[model samples]
Target: MKLAFDRGRRTRAATWVSLGLTFAVALVVELTFADSSKADSPLDSKGDQGNSQVERGRYLARAGNCVSCHTSPGGPAFAGGLALNTPFGKLYSTNITPDPETGIGKWTEEQFARAVREGVRPDGAHLYPAFPYTAYTKLSDEDVSALFAYMKVVKPVSFTPPENEMGFPANQRWALGMWKMLFFDEGRFLADSSQSEEWNRGAYLVEGLGHCSACHSPRNFMGAEQASMAMTGGEYTDKVPSGEIRTWSAPNLTDVPNGLGSWPMEEVAAYLRTGRNGFTETHGPMNEVILNSTRHLSEGDVRAMAVYLKSLPGNVGNIGKAASAQVIEDGETLYNVNCGTCHQPTGLGALSEQAGAKLVGNPLVQASNPASLINVILYGPHLAKLPGPKRWKDMPEFGSKLSDDEVAAIASYVRSAWGNVGGAVTQEQVAKQR
Candidate 1:
């Protein structure tokens, strides 16, 4: 996530001119064939004055987790200025507050709907996929109108975000049209007739506003999500409080031995609601998602999401290899000396005391990627303080104490022992995380 603009600009001017002409034609083609239908009628006629519609919109915004990306640290909510670092470039989120000059105050409902569903700005500029409009495009018309209504009423803030620092070709906004043609599919969520009403509701939320796949699914060279491998896990970087960029793995959501196959529906619901199940607790980015989004959802909606997630078929094709026996043995020795007091020799964990999480049958320990497992061993879990009586102390950081080989040994041991099937950790992987 280095700033592309900081790189030396030595390219010939002809290269820019050639790319500009190509993109201009692509933009014209995209706009020519784009759907021109007007937005549907509002769900309610009372406009923003309708308390019920506004309230529903407020809840939907929570489901969308809008503020998490829109607001900068210590800044007004929705007065966006968050820097989103991606492989292609850095993009700053735009202010969504109702400020006429700097936010969405002057945007009409049709303009808002088009932006959310079509990835097109009011002035006809193509928005980068980093906005997750690909998933938002699946939102129902009613939900779109409700969201617009809610946004219209938020307090206005007159802050403008910093300009995006994308590299030469990516800095070309019109190039996004060609990217869309290759991967984007604009449409609303279609309910399955064979599925239960609760299941359908869950699918709508997860596929549309929740935008779960945007994080959970792996992306290709062009940064589009791989449709065939949806939710088998993905990796992304987040800026830690220490200002260092850290890579994190989003575990597979499918029903598999290494994923959620072993998790009960109730456990999934509990985790979403409270950020912890009896077996494991959330840390890092997931903590923010639960705190800002899922925890605020209704009980029925939570259960529905759990049901849908549990129904996903496991991807058996991508299972990892077991760690070497010698590595596991060394790891076990380290675990006994440093971890057994809290985790116990059996790996059952002391949930009542909250000293450690259950490693046996833990989805994270058995994830396809071992990045998060290694991260925890190196940095300790930066577990957020929730509203409850304190039962255990925070896990200490081992980064300063453990050698790269020793850390890899411990990670390899947990990932392969106790019937876990995740891949072994290499000293090289440990060094990268450090």
Candidate 2:
């Protein structure tokens, strides 16, 4: 009986040992294969790469809107000194140059792909979502290759930007790995066979590579976008000193009653490419996007984005239009009293381009999103270093000049009379902002 009991104990011990060994082996396999840092570069010289590859890379850069994030204010394009503000803290943009020390210059194509597709740098660091790899995860392997190809040729900037500023519990960088475990799924885009090539291209640009929704979409308390309300305007502020109060909201993009619904596709494309539509010149965060990224895109690419925006399928209420009887009467009276000297009764404020400001079809008039209009009304934007003060977006601040009621009245009239959605505005909302 003693011998039998000893034999049975040995068998149980053997079973436990085998199970542990199996688990260890399985973990090794999973970790090795699921390693996301494999986006290293293919060892090809700039001169060795095909001309088409380089050209395509340039196109992809524009489509992905890389410059918008990397470029510094009053600095070289893609030179990488921009600061991004988040609820957790402020994070600066990094250099994407070929510089060996300061940039991704030495990373192989595989390493670069991992950074773009998986938000893990070649050095095994997790990138902040402010880099927008959430949308980039959908980028095709071929396009990711081309983007790396283009990045390899650019002049490398040697300066590393500032470190992230966050309060305790938020400053922990490794915590992002857990965040990724919850949010990221590195996968390629699956096209719907029924859609036109144009539509597919548009979807790629808007949802996958361009990441327009990062700024345009509203976020929950967790900082993740509310996908259902994608691009439908929300709160934002510039990431500069004390980060200028972004009391001026981002307007909704698909609220037809409030956003680009009344505008035509051609105009949208034109605006994206040139930073101007008959109604308004791009300003606020949009101005940076245009000047850095969209303006560099191909006409075809711009058209594709326009088409996608027009096809959003969901609609929100317009918050810019204010055409009620009281609002319009007050607006016209205010315009004639304060603005008639320069702008005509038609509200087609003309542009001098070389001289003073114009008040014409500024998106404020028909803004479906209230942020742009409210910003201009409350804070008044500056002309900055641009060539002309003649732009309509360069309006002076009227926060001190107009009462909350008056500002609401003028904004209401402008939004409604110009074929706007006629959304109502309240004096209380304006006062709250002030």
Candidate 3:
């Protein structure tokens, strides 16, 4: 009886000690992050206000793809109203324009910096990860200041975004502080001394302002990107402005067979700059990326990005087998009859923007999955409406005209033919994407 009592007492004491330790840790973290609110800006004393600062900010803003998320279609630039669909609920972007009433105009420089890097609002509320502050946290003070300068100079429109539609506990903004405690690592870009300046620059742009991993890397149920599989590609589904549901497979960016390994740096740079290379064309979300962000960048920056991407460690994923002899034969027949005139008998379509787009050795064609290929075949590009040079002509949707088998056959043929070696796609795969 005495021993049992002593054991029970020990257990209770241990429990109390654990609770105390947890509270102490929580207090330390809260104090650490809250200190960001009072953080000083090195640029505070510079007093560097001029067109050059604004212009530098403009470049940084473009690199960050600020307008794409912050602005709605037909709305004034940066007057945020875009609805971002997440597992929790639809979250609308807040206006970052300089309007005193509706936007960040009232925010002090310190307030803005804290929001950008620490994901904390001026009111001490936590922001959702949908804002991509996880990646933005790596931004340097200079770039952050430049971004602020540019935003302040933009024409501020008087409009407030609608409230986010988060369900239940997710709506509790305080909980996001816990989420940050678990995942957020507040820091600036640390250049690898071993790499060249260009490589480091590219790494900074891709990992920080570009936030490429947000879409390319697979995410957990909670939506935090998997660090282990960074830039290896993943699945993304979204509802378009037209209310059509669309899904895309962001291809791997590594230098593996499943990625951009075969493509030259020039091809990569061209694709970024113009939305089209000789090999493949950008459509869907990538089109918006090029139109709004990469296309506006200088040639040197674009080249540097390509250099960095091509240097990532390769990660080869589950690759399917080549189509059977019978499947290829049927696909060849269908291709000749339905797809040949445009894509050509050789599978190398014309280079002219008005003509058919190149398909042979196209990276999208060679992706591990056939979702993107099937999507374009069924829906014909589902192109985003944005201002840019029209680099590729939109193709007609053959979803209704061609049966699933025929579509699969043609896709298989494209994957296997013209020096392309991507594995054959299945009918079930085609049906699901459809």
Candidate 4:
């Protein structure tokens, strides 16, 4: 009885100590993040703040790719109607406009910065991970301030965002406090002495304001990123704006032999500048990036990004497997039987008579999974929506005719055949989209 009592007492003491530590840490963090001072900016002066503020805001929006989540296709900018699907549930984006109630009209710079960098809203509600604060945490205070300044001057949106479609347990915003504790780190880019100025700048953009990690990083079971394996992506899923099912396997961005290491700098720049490279095309999440974020960047910035990505060290020793025989064989046979008409045996589809796309050299063949290939086969890629590419390959939707397994097989075949190097597509992957 005495020993049991002592053990219970020890456990209670430990709990108290843990709670005390958490409180102290939280206080330190809150104080450190607090801005002790600020000058009267143009927004504080109570007016339009001039063309410069608006233009600066536009740049900040572009840098952050605000349109990616906030603006639905053919919808008003920052309207907050986009619905993001996640493993836990669906999260609807909020209006960032300056409307007094529905929009951010009442939000101070502090509120905006906290939302952007810390994933907390004006009312102190936690935001869904879809907001990508993990990457935004690295944004400089000055940039955050500039972004808030810009949003304030924009047209106010009177619209209220749709409710988050999450169910019970997952809908609890307080859970994110635990999530943030595990994943969130408040820090800025620290330049390495060994790298060049251009490389460092690229690193800052890709790792910071751009939130490339949102797409590229693999998430833990709790939806936190496994940071050690930074850009070697795992499974990610979504639906395109057109209501066709879409999923993604954010490919490894590190400079492994089969990863970004194979691509030349010019090819990387071309893909970033335009939507297409002779080797592959961007779709799904990357399509948003090209249409909104990357393509709009300066050529110098694009090249710098390419350089920085290329300069990354080879992957850690642990790597996934090559395509299996069963997967490869079934996939190849299906492609030949069904896909030969358009994509052909070589994986080269007739994108256009003069402008053709090669499947062997294509990025789709080398993606981390069969999601893009399956998506393209189900719903043709929309490469022509932007300025970069005039011509694109459009495969007819095979959803009605093809079984999920058949689609998986074909994707698996394409990935393994014709010098392509990526993981095999299981029926499980195909089933997730269907």
Estimate every model's Cα lDDT from 0 to 1: 0.76, 0.63, 0.73, 0.66
lDDT of 4 by residue, 1-434 (tens): 44445887886555544433322112100000011111112233344656676666667677667766676445567777776654335567778877788988888888888888888997888776677777788888878887877788766657877786765556667867876776678676688889899998888888887777666666554556667877765455555435643555566677764467668888888888886775666665566667667777888888988888887766532234665798788888887887776667877666663433567645445656556667767665544355544454454577778998888788777766766666677778777766
Model 3 C-alpha lDDT per residue in residues 252-347, reported as the tens digit of each score: 787876678777888888888776777776666676677768888999999999999989998755457999999999999999998888788897
Better of 2 and 3 by lDDT: 3
TM-score result, candidate 3:
0.81
Candidate 3 total steric clashes? 0
Model 3 segments more than 4 A misplaced: 1-50, 239-243, 320-329, 352-355, 382-394, 416-429
Which candidate tops lDDT?
A: 1
Model 2: runs farther than 4 Å from truth?
Answer: 1-50, 74-77, 181-185, 239-245, 317-336, 339-369, 379-394, 412-419, 422-434
Ranking by lDDT: 1, 3, 4, 2
> What is the lDDT, from 0 to 100, of the residue 219 in candidate 4?
58
Point out where model 1 deviates above 4 Å.
Answer: 1-50, 390-393
lDDT of 4 at 232: 63
lDDT of 3 at 57: 87
Better of 1 and 4 by TM-score: 1
In candidate 4, clashing pairs total 3
Model 1 lDDT tens row, 1-434: 77454224535334444443332222100000011111112222334555787778888988987877777766777887777665445678889877899999899999999999999999999986667788899998899998888888777779999997766775878767877887799998999999999999989888889989877777665567777888887767774333466666778898887788878999999988877887787676676677777888999999999999999988742556667889999999999998888887888887666567788878777666677777888888766555565445467888888999999998888877777778888899889888
| Alpha-carbon TM-score of each model against the true structure | 0.87, 0.74, 0.81, 0.80
